[model samples]
Target: MAPRRYCRARLGGQSRWFLDRGDHLLDLQSAVDGDDVPALLRHLADTDVTWAPPGGAVQVDPARVEWQVPVPRPGKVICLGLNYAAHAAEGGNAPPEYPALFLRAATSLIAHDAPLIRPRASDRLDFEAELAVVIGRRARHLDAAQALSAVAGYACFNDGTLRDYQRRTSQWTVGKNFDGTGAFGPWLVPAADLPPGATGLSIESRLNGQVMQRDNTGHMMVSVTQALVLLSEVFTLEPGDVIAMGTPAGVGYARTPPVFMKAGDRIEVEIEGLGVLANTVEDET
Candidate 1:
């Protein structure tokens, strides 16, 4: 049997684990408690018994479930800025020796298919397609050689940005932290089932079915292993922590005539082997 993907969904007003079994969804929480990465992997490895849904019926249609960000409240949401050389050149920046890191608040995140709220304070709502890495084990001061081992899985992410605010100052905190700007998830693919470090995968973004940005994961200035190694040097990475690898060239603000998302536009970030993360834009009410 193929390895199962996992997602968090809101059903009956409670958050629970939903297993992606290809043709149908299974209530994973019915089979195990605590959907943390390590625990989930252990449960799968220790048992050969087929997991059945509660009462032997599919609890909810995946399309109908209210998707929640895979890691609803990650301890740390680290983002890499201008980590792609082509993106850097477009932005008129030179490649840096170290990753340009920034932190995002939990409140900035929205789930797959959820609306990305464009704040009235800014009209430059830009889309950045990125590959998100979810850490499973505690890691500190690790080298690149051991970095991949610390990861649990990978997911699709949209690093929605308020460009005007981002350039208001050298610090990008305010612009990147606007509520409901980060769209993550849909589901998480376990690392064991994917190519190591998810390298060479095609990553792209589309606005209302029109391709806006596209690149391969192999182009990142800092690979997953290197990013993990550098990050752990600063602080201990705990389970559920997320690292959003930087976007590639072709982001809205870098184009000759910039393209920004507005109300009613559907934006999608797709990564090969990971899956597509889709969200619609909504004006802040």
Candidate 2:
């Protein structure tokens, strides 16, 4: 069977499962084995990508449902820092000999069309456009050859950060974990649908319709395969886990005057082929 885009959503207080099949959404809940993304990924891996869609599944109206992060509860939301050479230099640092990594609480994640909150503590909310990988199976000590097989799919991520909070200490967890800052999803494109490691794709971050950061996935200092191989070496990767590959240069804090996202501005992170993840900025109330 051919690969398809998928998502989890809610409509009128009811959570729903949907598979994008071009013209309309096929309600996966109506399928013989109705389940969410994690379950679907598990089934695919065990069965070799053979999925039979619901024969009489209802067609869902996209306008009626609210998008949710494709991976509902990733045990590990691992993020990379300074993965791009230009991004590293912009921050006045040299590319590291090893990947700089951080963790984000699942509480920080927000769905597409949701508001990216600027916490009451600071207005330095910034955008970092990234490509996130969703792990499909349990993996430990993955080798270079096993990296691609462990991946479930790819999605767009806006690592909305509070610069001041991030720098207040050496660690970035506090600044990065403010509720509703991580904007993820709209859809997930299967790993089989793209080139190895999801490379060669154009990734961009735009603020209020103006492009702020743009680059190719190929520019990443630590390739996706490498990150997975390296990450698994230290920790076991589980199904539904997310690995945010890091952003390119042009982050607000590195600018001459440093522009930041404020209330009422629309921020969009787009990864070619995967789809766009867009959200409005709002102040913490």
Candidate 3:
């Protein structure tokens, strides 16, 4: 088989990167003309290259550009709920006997630097900084040991929620899938470099330089591998699919006075090794 080549658009303006199937770096402009993505990925799988080209025609200053999600389209965006113990306690509950799960439809997908729009339908939008796993291969009924092997990489994710509706109903779907609600990326650091096997880790959320939610992944009721295996038992996860491990304690809705998002507010979600996801809230016109 040829090496698998994964094309990635970098955060800097006009700069792009590609990771071949073997995870080796490839030339940035090799994809400038926009090659057939899937086909390139297939070819990259069998070959190995260690270094990328030194320069390109377009130069970009990092400070002036906006970031975008790593993948433009994904087959599925799987989300976990109450997976963190402290978060469950904050919500006035015990760790679920099983991992609580949910799905955020594709429409909710947005990039890292994009504005998080205040959903017109709800005003209680909230932020959840989480460790997200991106699947690299088709998986189903995999044992816990095999779960991590199926992961493509890791990235930061903000599981934005519409609080009023989330609390108003038992099903969390409606409140979770509003436009610009799921902000993930700027990059997909391959699984090899990221801590694997669902071990302990930390995740945090901040607003205007103030830390709001800070918790460790070690407290997750179900480890990342466990969540992957459990979800795989039911649904087939494909490459590029994402899973938001879960948020920690201290969500705005769980606060004493409840601190919800308002227009003109800036939020950032950071995870141990994944990187940071930042967005500014803006009124939905």
Candidate 4:
């Protein structure tokens, strides 16, 4: 099988696009829009569409349209726990004995620019800026060196979470998977173009233009490759699946005087090369 080309764009008055397989030799166009890009993909996984070459210079309206989560329907949203050393320490925890891991159900994902709702059950909602790796191929027990090769691309994901709920449970699942908590991407750039080192990529989060969380991916306790390798060993990693590499410290939950998200708050997550994802907070009714 050749590398698959996945794209999300506005089509037919909705945010949607076609996935082309190598120069349009094969393709699948779908109308699934809003925040269900991934569902459209799974619907046409087995079909192939005829690709048409660009007839002329293609034009687009960036402002009038929007891009969504590359995999609007990922089967599993795998996440790294305590991958960031600083983040772990902030929680009064030591580095992971091994790669701490977890998964966020797909329903928690919201497309770019979607409103991040603050759950009525929790008052300490927070944002975790992370680099998300989109898996490209099925793999199990992959080696560290082969991990990057399995990646299709990378995107900026804001792991919106509720701190109080998360701490109440031994497992981080409930608090981390609140509706509209996962906001990522305006676009998913291919991994081939991403930075090669574990460092140099700057990740930051800002609330109302005030800087909140800032760090380099290099500080991760487990590098991206390491996390992939470890995860693949546990299960068959499928294409379009995502791995949120974990957020650095500075979460509202751990601040000296805890800060939480409220209605009217505008949070922005930015990764150096990748574009920023901005979303507003809306209180749950």
Candidate 5:
């Protein structure tokens, strides 16, 4: 069976789960809480509910509902850096033997179509298009072969960064964690719906409607399965934990004439199977 697509949205000031049933958006939040992916999947499996037409089940217009990050408050947001060989080379560095890992706070992320704030502290705001893996089951110390089973779905992610701050230190935490910089969602596509590990899909990023970065998932130096297995070696990977499988080449900072995001600019990250995540840039007040 093909997997279903799900989204977390704010309707009438309340966050809810929405099922994309092709013709209509079903309000799954009314049936089950949006927090548990595995539980929601089970509920969907057992239910025989039919999708309601637009404004049938939920009277609110989807456009009126404010979008929220698919996983609003994940326990951990693990990001991979230099996971693509081309990206590493573009940055003037060689591929590392192990994945360069980093952490992003939930506070740093905003939902699709929301504004991504360019911090007042820096003008070097850059965009990174990445594939986000959402963990459905708890996993610890699993091998590469068993790691992919723990993933529930995939989503598009923009690992927005403050380049100047990011280069100030060896640690990337501060530059990568600017509040409301990370743009995630649009929706989550179930793993079974796409090729294993989301490989072979075209992943690209656009700035103000112009293509800025383009690549394929198959080009990742560190594959999703390997990332999960490697990460689990340090600590347990719990449900709701996210792994951003890193960005590709053609980043703004790597260009001959660097191009960074500024206020009023729109940025979008699109993955072939996962859908598009679009956000506008706003200056921090």
Candidate 6:
């Protein structure tokens, strides 16, 4: 059976869910307001969702809708920072003994194809490509062996950063939580579709059509299972909550002649099996 993929979208102010069908969207739910994660979580528990629904698949053209963040309003948008040894070294820091984690506000996220807003406060917008893990159900205190079961799926993410604000304080929250800077989702591929923890997958990022970062998920210092286990020990990971696996080396701020994104720049993050997430930068008016 083919793997399942989903896209949460908005059309004319109504939220809807769609299963990805070849070249079209198979409408999976009636139009509703607010998030669409609860329904999916229920369906996920019952079956694999590998077959098309009975009503001949109510399909729509891809262009008819606007994409929304995979988990539109995550209860927690926890992120792993400096989770790659090489990425840590690039910033003149040694590998961490524990995962460097941070929280990102939902306001910071933009959907695939949406314009990534470069705030007026800074022209130092930077991109960090990453893999996002979506929690499947409520989980707490899970050990490493049980961690993979807590994951619902995976998506591509661009952890857009503002360099100056990031350095102004010891905490990275301010810079990382700027509205509309984070880019997430084109689609979410079910965990059953890929290797466990999505390991060994090739992940890459591009700026204005030029490859800027490239690496494999296997190289992460803290693997997906480890991150989940570690996180669940402290707090519960509920359905639709997201965890952004840290980016690999080659970020703009670390380059020889620091490169940053400006208005009209395009950025894309792609991961094997998961779809590509692309966005164009626009200045805050």
Question: How do the predictions measure up, each by TM-score?
Answer: 0.92, 0.94, 0.84, 0.84, 0.92, 0.95
Return the top candidate by TM-score.
6
Displacement of the residue 121 alpha carbon in candidate 6, Å: 0.7
Off by over 4 Å in 6: 30-34, 45-47
Off by over 4 Å in 4: 1-7, 18-52
**lDDT tens per residue, model 4, 153-175:** 77789999888788887888888
Q: Where is model 2 more than 4 Å wrong at Cα?
A: 1-3, 32-35, 43-51
Scored against the true structure, residue 248 in model 5 reaches a CA lDDT of: 96
Q: State residue 257's C-alpha deviation in candidate 2, in Å.
A: 1.4
TM value for model 4: 0.84
Residues 26-119, candidate 1, lDDT per residue (tens digit)?
Answer: 7776555534545654433333445565666455677767888888689899999989999999999999887899999999999999999999
Ranking by lDDT: 6, 2, 5, 1, 4, 3
Q: How many clashes (backbone atoms < 3 Å, residues ≥3 apart in a chain or on different chains) does model 1 have?
A: 0
Better of 3 and 5 by lDDT: 5
Taking the tens digit of each residue's C-alpha lDDT, what string does model 3 give over 121-184?
8889898988877777777899976778877667788999998877777888888988888888
Worst lDDT window (10 residues) for model 3? 38-47
Report the lDDT tens digits of candidate 5 across residue range 90-119: 999899988899999999989999999998
Q: Write the per-residue lDDT of candidate 2 for residues 1-285, one digit (tens) a residue.
A: 444677778865766668787777877775533235567676545534645654767787787788888878689999999999999999999998988889999999999999899899898999999999999999999889878899988889999999999999988888899999999998887888777899999999999899999999999999999999899999989999999999999999999899999999999999888878999999999
**Cα RMSD for predicted model 5:** 3.0
Candidate ranking under TM-score, highest first, comes to 6, 2, 1, 5, 3, 4
- How many backbone clashes can be found in candidate 5? 0
Go through the candidates in order and give the clash count of each: 0, 0, 10, 3, 0, 0
